[model samples]
Structure formats: structure tokens, C-alpha cells
Target chain A: MIGIKELRAGDSLPEVRLNPVTRLDLIKYAGASGDFNPIHTIDAEAEQAGLPGIIAHGMWTMGNLAKLFTPYLEQGFIREYAIRFRGMVFLGDVVTLKAVLKDLQDQELTFEVAAVNHDGQDVLKGSVVFSAELPDL
Target chain B: MLKDSIGKRSEKVRNTIERGAVRKFAEAIGDPAPIFIDEAAGAESVYKRNIAPPTFPVTFDAGVIPELDLPSKGLIHGEQIYTYVRPLLVGETVYCWMEVKDYYERSGKMGRMGFLVMTKYGENANGELLFTEERIVIISEAVRKGMGA
Candidate 1:
């Protein structure tokens, strides 16, 4: 996935979508991550806390977004990855991650990454700076 | 208030990035990539062993600021950023700690809100930085109303 091919700014990187989030997914994330926040696990607790339902952890969504670039990660190091939580993601929503090449210089490439929920509403928005270009391989 | 927590840092916590946690995290995220769970596949890769996910450092948080008293229930995660020197390799012991970087207030529809920024960093045993995670937690109007002091 290293930038073996010639790439230019403005080209959209491949878009990838993860499996629909499930109650068990959140539960597993909670266990693995030690973030037992009830708002992500217990549905009743979430509603009581004024949420539509159990929402996935923002880190969970950000991690899923990172998955989209896994193929290219080995090519270089992640210099920076940032995301703003823009919308709430409920269980059963499939997250689609899209990234576009924003710039390339000095062996570094900047990309704009976005994650959209099932309804096409943007759930997360951010940018990533990687040490190399994955030549679209 | 959150402002009082400024400049506070967590205790130096050390933990090993184990394979079991990596497997669970990969499975939980529905990532079927073999390198995440298969040692054979990992051995064949550049790292020569399983590597944790990019955001895996979040799990290694030392703890929240002790004095940063904000409403416990109505706090929302605002923005987050993770910058890595490299993907954390499994089986490496990392020293982790965090500190309150910034705290400020702003007006929103709900009313005045407080945003607290904390930066967490993980470094290998040799004292080389592995990754840095910056988190922003916001206390909403509902939080203040709930406190009602």
C-alpha cells in the first residue's frame, strides 16, 4: 500500500466502510479498551442520560476511521491524526470512511478523512498526516 | 471547575501491550485483518509481530485528572487527536501519563460550556515517544444545571 504509484493532490483515496455497529461491538470495545462508560454499553442508562440510545465511543469511531488507511500504514508512520466528533452514532449504524489526498511534499502526505454514518450524516471529520504516499497500490 | 485542573498530570503508569488485548480490540472493531490476530501473518509483515491498532493507546490512559471536578454525567467528548511516532508493537512495555493541557469556557445554545483538554503520551522503555493522544472533554449546560450550586 506504500505510495508506489504516482499520486497528486486532490485525488480521493479509496473509501472503505466497516460492518454495521452492534451492541456487542460496543460491548467488546468497552471491554478491550476499559472504557466502561454506561452510555456506550447499557441502553437504558443511555436514555436516562438523555441520549437517543447507546452511542459508540468517539475513539471507537476514530479507530474505525484509522482502519481505512491500514493498508498504507506500513508504508510510513502516522505523523498526525485528528478528528472532531460531529454527530452521534447509534448502534446498527454502518460507518463509511473516506479520505482525499490534500498535499504531498518532503516525503509527507496530508489527507482529509471523514466518517459518515448510515444516514450519510457526517459523524466525524479530521485530517491525517502520514510520512509517505501509498502509491495507490 | 475544570480550570482548577490545569497543569495537572497523571502518575507515570506503565503497561505492556499484550496480544490478547490486541485480539479483542481487533475483533471488537470487526477488523478481520490477519496481522492483527495471526502471529504467522504478523511475523511475515514488516513488524515481524502483531502490532496494536493506531488508537490502542487510549486504552492505556493513566486516569482522568483527579481535581478536574466537572459534572460527572453530562460531559461530552469534543475533539480528539492521536499522533504516532509509529504503530505500537505488541509485547512492548510503554510508560504512559497525561496532563491537563487547557481549560476554557464558551457560550453555546445550552449556555456557558467548559472545554477541558488533556494530552496523553506513551513512550517505550527506552524513553522514546510512541504516540500522543490529545482529548477534549466538554461540560455542557446540562451539567451545570445538574450541579445547581
Candidate 2:
């Protein structure tokens, strides 16, 4: 488990690997999140939307990132985190998530985080801020 | 009759926020960077890995469906903030619990005033708490000529 004290500005978080994008993953996400946007499941819909191919849901990737810190951030230490959409993830694309500690305090922590795809492109860009003394997981 | 309409208009949906889907969203927004498509693209960056686009979770990670009975001119997305432990990647699955966190009704000079806050919680596949997002939207009655349509 990673503790906040172990991180520092310009410090990168551990790397996380993901499984291949599968139809089941998308279907399960649709059912679980209540977002029935056809573009997620149907290739025709995505093509109609002028996309290159079917894509995964944005939140799913974000969830994967959360899973990385599952052991550390079980409590209320994280205060605020937000990201801006910049790129896309094609089906079967293996994505990775990395974060650098931007700031730290006894009560709060901040980091500039990024998500990148296989070809050296940025899929998501944003900053996250969390409380330092958070609840235990 | 109204109850049924309400039920039909407002319904809870299960959503999964994944990485590949975030890439498509980037395409929709006119961004086709490989970082969103291929994992190796992230190798050079300090992050040392591929990551999903921020706010990509808004697509499937579940949120409360609002019932708009009033004839509003336009629904405008004002602002949004997401808090999370780490950045997201392509194949991760997360469950969404969405709801109307708050609402404000006010009377303006021209017509009625209203604002809505939609909140959603994204949980990992293991049912662990991931993060929360608050979406703010504004609604107002449209000004029409003669009798309002």
C-alpha cells in the first residue's frame, strides 16, 4: 500500500496495467452506471457518430485509476480531484495511468495526473487534490 | 398519467466507465491522440504509462436522470469537478451511483429560475469507493413570440 508520506511533487505513482477492452466490460458498465449511450456498445452507432470504432466509457478508465490507490485512499483524505477530456481510447487499447506528487501538507495532498495510451499520446489530463490525514480504509 | 410519465422520463441506469470508451469520447471532441488509443504512447511521459481522459467517466459511470417537464430553452453544462485516487486507464470497470444532489429554484425578472446539481459516485469493480463528480446545469423557460409554445 502507498502512503501519502511516500509521495512528493514530481514523484510518479506506481504504474497500473489493464486488461484488454472487451464487449463484456462495456455491457457490464452500461448496466452498472445507467449510461445507455448506444455509442458504447453498438459499432453502427459509433460509426454513425463518426467515430473510428467502438470505444470504452470514460468513467471506467477513471475507475481503474481509483483501483490503483484502493489500498491507500480508503478514507476521506482525498479532498478534490478533476480532469479534462482531451483524447480517446480505441477498443483493445491498453491504457496506463501515472501521477506525480505536486504538493503535500499534513492535511492535504495534490498531484498533477495524466493517463496515456499505447502510442505515447495523452488520453486524459487533470489535477487531483486530497486531504492528508484521511480516514483509514 | 403523470406518475407514469415521470417514471418513463426519469429512470436509473447502470453504467460502466471504461478506457476504450474514453478514447471514443476524445474522438467525439476532435482529439485523436495516440495516448488515448495505444498504451505505449504513455511510456515517454513522466506518468510512465497510458491514462484515460479526464471526465471520460461522465459517459457511463451512472448518474441521476433528471426529469425535465418544463419547456426549457436550452440545457447548459456549467461546470464539473472530479476527485479520484489515481488516473484512469483503458480497461477498468466502475459502477456508478448517481442522484440529484441538490436543486435551487428562484424567480427571475423574465421568468422562473432553476438550477440543478447532479452528483455521481464511481466505484471500482471490487465495490470500492473511487471518487465523486458534481455536474451543474442551468434551466430556463424559452421566450417565444406571441403565445409561448
Candidate 3:
């Protein structure tokens, strides 16, 4: 993990990957999120709704992206963060989340983040605003 | 049917941020960030207590006075945007409010689809702001038709 001072404007954060989104993963999410939308939990219902079996909740992918920034969250100085869902994700799709330093101020840093699937299709994209003291630098 | 809610904002609903729920959320997202799950580590970390990941606001709803009584089925989550005031702390009570900000339509590969843009927020018990999550829900024509069923 790089310290805030070690990060350059174009530094890339280590990517987080989740392979083969499974049906059980969606079930756990449905339970944890309290979002029991059948499109995400039941395979047959998803097909009835014109989807390719059960789909991943958009928040699931976004939450994976947050995992990439979990180190920062541990230190507790994140000032702002936001994301936009750009594509759909289905069961069995491998997902990857990435981020790059966008800017740096006296004590703050911003980064553009993305989550993409196996075909390089976007699932989510967003940015975060964080300001914190250098801890291990 | 949702068009009627274009600018309707719901009354604020209050809820407490619980540590157990925060840990469940962390595990569900597969994020093992110590500050979000380990109280011991958190006690030594910056916040001195477990905190939630930025996207954890998805679980904080008591009930929204929905202005749009649209069909719940077949409505997909199109997009979501979250802006933070600071990281939310576990066991902190906060007030949440929601509103349908816009209603529009566009051509979809399937057919006509409606977009309902809604914004929700969390504020500390003292009335201080915490975070805002603006979400877009897409209702396909199939969903529109099923509303009467």
C-alpha cells in the first residue's frame, strides 16, 4: 500500500478482482443489502425479465470498487466519493476495479475509478475526494 | 405513472447505523477493510471505531413517502451517485430523506424505457450532513404494463 505522499498524479491503484460472480454471492448481497429484487436472486425470474439469468446488483460492483480504496477508508479521512453505473453484470462474469490518481492538493487527493468485466465492458466508473494526514510515509 | 413524482421529495426518515450491520455489509461486499469490520484494529486506527465503506448507505432506509406509486417489478437500477461529507461511523444515528428529482424517457433496444431519478441523503442526528446518494431507476415498458396486474 502506498502512502498519500508517495502517490503521484498518474499513479495506478492496485486493481481488485472478483472472478465468476456466483449465484450465492448474489444471495449474500441480497441479504446484506436488503435488496431482494428477484432479478438479482432468482435465475428464472431474471430470464422472465429479459435478463441472462440472475444479474449482479449495480451496488455490488460499486462496492467492489470501494474495496480498492479500503486502505484509505481504514485511515478515515475520505472527504468525498461518487460513482455511476455504466454497464450490466451477470452471474459468471469476472469483474475488475481500478483507480488512478487524478489530482493532489496540499492534503487531499482525487482519483478516477472504474469497474469492468471480462470483455472490457464497463460496469461502473466514478471518482473520490480524500484528504488525510500521511500515516506511514 | 412515475411522472407524477418528478419533483416530489419525501419526508426525512431516521435510522441508526449499527456495527453488526456494517460488518455484514463489509463481508457482503468482500471488503475486509479493518476499520469497517474489526473494532480492535479500528480502536487503533484514525476513527477509533468501526466505520462503513462509502457505498454502505444503500442499507439505511426506514421508509420513504414515495411520490411515485409505480410498479416495483422490472425496474432496474440504471445508475447511482454518492457524495460524502465524511465517512459514516458505526452506531451513529442519522436521518435520511429521499425525493424523485426527474422523470424522463428514451429509446431502448427493447423499446421505450422510463428513467426516474431519485436522490436520498443521510444527516447526523444533530442535523449535520453525512452523505447523498442519487439513484436512477429504469422502468421498461413491460414494467409499465404490469403495473395494473
Candidate 4:
């Protein structure tokens, strides 16, 4: 139902607010991602690794963004999405997800996406590219 | 710290980013896209070859820099952005280096502290610049309540 033309530069997606990271979330993410770095779910282990405490997987945060774009790119519009880990996120931190249209081509659609924490820090900075043509159902 | 006699940047550490590692990443997230799995399907996509998910590049030999690490109760998932020079193939053996591109601090409700973390990556198997991914992250108390703390 969503079309690329509907999204334009400065258009904003519905705001996504997620629950704070809990030990359970980390455990679930570890089980799902199989990252089991120990630093993410184990408090002492994280400290030993020179980290403040248990942190969340970078992908988990990116997943929320993927979820946000799913409705628009549902059929096959999204070509790619990605991000690099800059800061470590620990249990209990709140992250805000947002996006803005950057450019659109008859061949592809693109936007700039970012995740900001409670402190107004841009936690994740990346782009999402989508196919301009709609897929046939 | 003493300067090296050769004056060359010491090989601090080499993070071997591999498919198996990325496979873990894809598995950790439960992404079953054919391109991420079936090599043939990826090759056929507009990207012209079997490619990992967009995030795949991050796991390919990512080198983390210090100071980007913030002291906190835990690391939080913040913002993520990716641009493509071309889609990555499943077994292309891509290599990358990560650096702390930027960092800053500010005052806020949690008592005057804010930070931004950024990293850039250069990719290749034969030393070619494929694409660059600059990731930015922020840390603050405002995140606590906003995330339902």
C-alpha cells in the first residue's frame, strides 16, 4: 500500500519508541543472534572486557529500524540497509528511531536513517535504499 | 608511548571479518532472505551477485577504535546508516578497517553528558575501495526514560 512517491525529502516515518533493554532482551537477542559475546549479557564479563556493563547487540537496534521500514518496502522495495557500531549500548538505555527521505530515483529510492538515544545522541547513522518499481503480487 | 623506529603504524590488531562470523550475525537476527542464504538468488538480484544483508559488511574484518567506548550500565542500540557502492557477495572475502571518526559530549537532563560515536570502513579483497559506512551513536540519560527505563 505504501509507494515510494509518497515519501519525500523531509518526510518522517512514524516515530518508533522501544522498551528499554533488559537482561531478558539481551538474552533473547543473544539466543537469536548467537553472538554470546558475554559482554552483552554478563555484567562482570563486560566490565572485564573494559566495558561499563552489559550491552545490546548492534543488529538488534538495526532490526527495529528494519521493522519500521517493512510496511513501505514490504513486497521488495528495499534494496539494502546497514550501519556500523560506534558506541556500545548497555541494558536500560532507551533508543529512538527516525528516518528522512534523502533522494529518489525512478530506479531506486533512498533515505537517511538514524537512531537517537534519550540524550539526543545520534546512535546509529545509515541509509536505506529501495527499489522504485513495485513488485507484482 | 615511544615512537616506532620505523615510524610505521604498528599492526595493533587485525579483526578477521568472515562469512562464518556474518553467518552468526544473520542467524542472531533470524534473517532468512535468500540472498543472505542461497548464493544463486543473491547473484540474480539487482546487486548482480549473492550478497550478505546490508549489515554484512560491518562484520567483515571490522576494527574497533577506543574512546568510542563509553562507560555505562550497558551499551545501547542507537542509530544505524548504510550506503552501498555495490551489494556485497556472500563469499567475496571483503576486508575493512574501523576507526573512531568522531566523538563529542554535551549537558542534558541526566546531569550534563552526551556523546556521539562514529566509525568509517574501507573495503576490498585486492585493496579496492568498495563503499564506505559511517556509523554514528549517542549516549545520554534522556535515553533511559525515553526507552521506558
Leading candidate by TM-score: 1
Model 1 agreement with the true structure over A22-115: per-residue lDDT tens digits: 8888888899888888999997899999898999998888888887667765566577899999999898898899988888887888889999
Residue A80 lDDT, candidate 4, scale 0-100: 61
Which structure among the candidates has the greatest DockQ? Answer: 1
- Least accurate stretch of 10 residues (summed lDDT) in model 2 chain B? B1-10
Query: How much of the true contact map at the interface does candidate 3 reproduce, as a fraction?
Result: 0.64
Task: Show the colliding residue pairs in model 3.
Answer: none
> Candidate 4: where is the Cα deviation over 4 Å?
A1-58, A67-108, A111-127, A131-137, B1-20, B64-77, B114-116, B137-149
DockQ of 4: 0.21
Where is model 2 more than 4 Å wrong at Cα?
A74-76, A135-137, B1-80, B83-132, B136-149
lDDT of 3 by residue, A1-137 (tens): 66765799999888878878998888988899999989998878888887877889988888878777777664436566677777888878999889999998877888898898999988888787776652331
Of candidate 2 chain A, the 10-residue stretch with the lowest lDDT total is A68-77
Per-residue CA lDDT of model 2 for A15-127, tens digit only, reads 76666677667777676545667777889888976788877766656555543443343333345666554676778887878778888877676777767888877776666
TM-score of each model's B chain?
Answer: 0.90, 0.65, 0.90, 0.63
**Over the stretch A1-137, how does candidate 4's per-residue lDDT look in tens digits?**
45657777778778777777778877866765555778878888888867778777777777655555644432345566766555656778888888888887776767778778887887677777776664331
Candidate 3 per-residue C-alpha lDDT over B91-142 given as tens digits, one digit per residue, 9 for 90 to 100: 8888998878898989979898888898887888788777888888888887
Q: Model 2: DockQ against the native?
A: 0.12
Q: Once model 2 is optimally superposed onto the true structure by TM-score, how far is the C-alpha of residue A84 displaced, in angstroms?
A: 1.2
Question: What's the lDDT for residue B90 in model 2?
Answer: 61
lDDT of 3 at B49: 69
